[model samples]
Target: MTTRISAVPRPAPAVDLAVPFADCHITSDAQAAVLRVLQSGWVTTGREVAAFETEFAAAVGAEYAVAVSSCTQGIELALRSLGLPPGSLVLSSTMTFCGAVQAIMHAGHQPVLVDVDPATGLPTPATVRTAVQAFGRPAALTVVHWAGDVADVPALAEAAGVPLDHVVVDAAHALGTYAGDAPVGSGPGATCFSFYATKNLPLGEGGMITTDDAARADWLRKARLHGMTADAWRRYLPGGSWRYNVADAGLKANMTDIQAAMGRAQLTHFPSWQRRRAQIAAQYDEQLAGLPGVGLPHRPAPGQGTHAWHLYPIRLRLNGGIDRDEVIAALSERAIGTSVHFIPVHRLAYFSQAALIPSAGLTGADALFGQLLSLPMYPRLSGAQVDAVCAAITGIAHQGISGKGTE
Candidate 1:
């Protein structure tokens, strides 16, 4: 039986407006899609999920795509499928979400943090070389498409002296990102994408792993569903039997049909959303240009690749009179929310253990961490909100400092 809920109305706040750093766009079609799934009675990984996987694979130009519960699980499943020996070293960026390092560790590997490019907060070919030169050859590397800017995969592989197959891309922020003539997932390595609430293609909470390797694809299919030879839908089909076989012990990381329905709806509307995001990014670039002591996010020249515009991370000149935290507080006071993209992985208490990641060599990451701040960015963010955000920032730059800047 369905329970009826009563509506509750509240008075508006005293502030002009409250602008969040990011917001999900849930279309009417998305709501209907979820309702259809709920009415279908088959809410697990079934027809809806199968269709989403197929359509998503085609969109990303990949041979196969496996939907998972989250990008973190997708990364772990990809790494586990590699069959790497225990204690294998996985080189990853220092300026990235904890999910990457946690995935490496969960997949029975040790994470060696690599410094990022000081300008863009991304790991470069030189960063890979430095990691290899310092830590010796890693069994695999987990490269992030930092803030949706495509990494130079070929150059990075050559520098690391590893084949392209040894790399797994954490493209959590890169759904519409392109690398040359191909999409981000249409490469030699496994690519993981997030559908978190704040991500480009928000599905509330889900992820996908795409790869061209048929063997790995097949393995991941089974690995995401408890290593069963056949999924529940397949077994329950008309001519199918309930019998199945266990291949290997796998984690439970399958995406439900309800989530897939939401994803499918979002996919249909993705192009328009992407276009709006790009437009907003352009406005930020034009309006926020040459603001004293502020560095805009790095954008690639035309034909190099396309950025997904997942974040607009601006660097605060820490040595300048204003401080990053003070700026954040000032913006908050103006009813706008800002966030820091990351704290260097080396500084985190768990990862700080000398055994996991040595802290001495992460000079670039450490330096970038103190300066980075993520401005409000999302498809639905209005021109007026963007204007107010910029004005608040400019005002803070003028008079936000109370004393010498905090390093």
Candidate 2:
């Protein structure tokens, strides 16, 4: 008997047809927005940034929304406004980006760690309680809404037993996610929303800090750049003096009017963009169901809150013959791209030692990390492309053997 070779090869599992991840989806509105800023001549920190700040605050239902260069800077500035004593503990959930931890550290405070809800990988009342018990009374609490899922924000704030001022939300992923009738920023001390290249309201790079407190808002606006008593826009306005006061030493983190122009354009498309994201997420949920080793990203109940669908993170189930890594590799081979929402702030080498990780002593972050996988999700992602990605996942998920390639 001779072994014969077949001429036709296996169709590389339908060559990944999913649309590229991180598509900015800038519309014709972007051109007009940019042109308006350009035509004004006075770009940099001008009327555009100020206008964007005002509009964004109104959009988020906050009394004030200050624009900044980046979400990390926004978080830092928010923490600085808190003015907690140096070395004081600033508690925050562990299952989050390193920026939150970096903000706390740079604020000259001790970062205390808190774990998140086991199922959703979001902060919960219990996690907050445990953090308080473990880390003691913190100078403040940094509440993070990871993966666009609003955590038990109110509950966590209540459990902390601190005044509302102690709450500072790193809501980079919650620009559009809401709890109850309020968006992520409302009812908390301050919530920082990102407008990064991959965010729901991508603006190349920018962020907003929404707050109800007038004093804090004023301080943040001043603190973003050298703690000047007045902003550059004010100085350059007609009849305004170049003379200004530096109340405190601040960092250079102000957002330019050009970036704000992009923000304004993105905001116009926000409602439709979010709808598209939700639809894509729903499609993923429907198409990926019952695929072995793959669990669709959990969605919060509509009555409980509004979900922005900033990320569609599926946890690769270990029991499935195909593990997370193998499936991810298979998807990669087909051209579908993916990323882990986070590696857990405490786990990152940059903030490892002496860092306050919300899940420091627990297995919470570790458990969440072991199986997490974020699928490509964006307004530009097409229905057919979504289907192709889902089909690839479906095939890989069903294959027997739990491989580590998913995350």
Candidate 3:
């Protein structure tokens, strides 16, 4: 069956309001939770953080959860907890945020970059095997769930000849995501999640780490707060002693009660938000699927797990004479916001000059980078807004095909 979008150009909609690439949706319950924290007299990591950790663990089907100040620190802490020797190599995708790579460095390890599947922007088992062959076996593997799509961490680890315990997931875009029947955090490694202002569960700033290992969970608890024998809540609260000891030098990356409170409230509304995100993604898939020169986001196979839809990234077939940036400008002109998912970590100036080794040719990531375009994706985005964005894109596709050049 031949599938194609009409060649006729749709008139650009009136630009009364500009759609933002990302926006935070704070519910009234979230506001109340934050307010309660502000009035509690205890604002730092305490009871609220503990309760949030418990709830979050249950939400993600993990045995234990540790709240952190940021996803970067969560990755660093998870890597450090592994007790790997300093300067040990860690395998990660080249098509990921630089912060994840920096986390490996922060944990006193060298990063070995690996190529990704061009279509999904995720590393496959074959790519992991190639990296292992080129850079020798790494002490650990940090797999990123790019754009809310889950990567098979256990499989990737096996391919790299690394154990499941050595796998760490940079799940910044994958909180509600799943792998088969299990939630992302329920997998083999320490999975880290983000709650940045633009993330699905926005708390202004926060992160979480989930693991099944009790010992590691305990280590993470103390490690997040300077390896203290007892946190502030334990020392200052009733029936608590003032004495404490620092077991190991650790990062001050504990999440505060304020953030935890907001996180809990956000969790309450998370299911509905996830549904809305999926709906928006479906709208894009339906509208943009048959458009010439437009490649829709990758959809996971049945039973592979559901995408969290953190980003609605589409690829442009640049060979069709449609420039990705030009299309971006056209969307901007129509008050439709868009952004690139990432600039490959290796391409960044710091990483380019760093000691990081590319285990294999990064042709896949490199090719996907030039064509990537992330459209506005958030829980609060209305259906009308989605239609407008799709319309603008459709118009751009038609123009490009006719050699009008997105002018």
Segments of candidate 1 deviating more than 4 angstroms? 1-17, 318-320, 400-407
Screening candidate 1 with a backbone cut-off below 3 angstroms (N, C-alpha, C), the clashing residue pairs are: none
Worst 10 residues of 3 by lDDT: 1-10
* 1-407 per-residue lDDT for model 1 (tens digits): 21111122434443444798778887899899999999988999999989999999999999999999999999999999889999998888888998888999989898888888888788888878778877788888888888888788788777777778888889998898888777899878799999999999998899999999999999999999999989999999899999989878799999999999999999998888889989999988887788777889987778988999999899887334456876676666677878887988888888877324543578888888888899988988999999998887765554433322333
Residue 301 alpha-carbon offset, candidate 3, angstroms: 0.2
Cα lDDT of all candidates, in order?
Answer: 0.84, 0.79, 0.88
Worst 10 residues of 2 by lDDT: 1-10
lDDT over C-alpha atoms for residue 43 of model 1: 95
Query: CA lDDT of 87 in candidate 2?
Result: 91
User: What TM-scores do the predictions have?
Assistant: 0.93, 0.91, 0.94
Candidate 2 Cα outliers beyond 4 Å, as residue runs = 1-18, 318-321, 357-360, 401-407
Please give me the total number of clashing residue pairs in predicted model 1: 0
Candidate 2 lDDT over residue span 163-229, tens digit each: 7777888888998998888877766488888988889888778889989889988888889988998
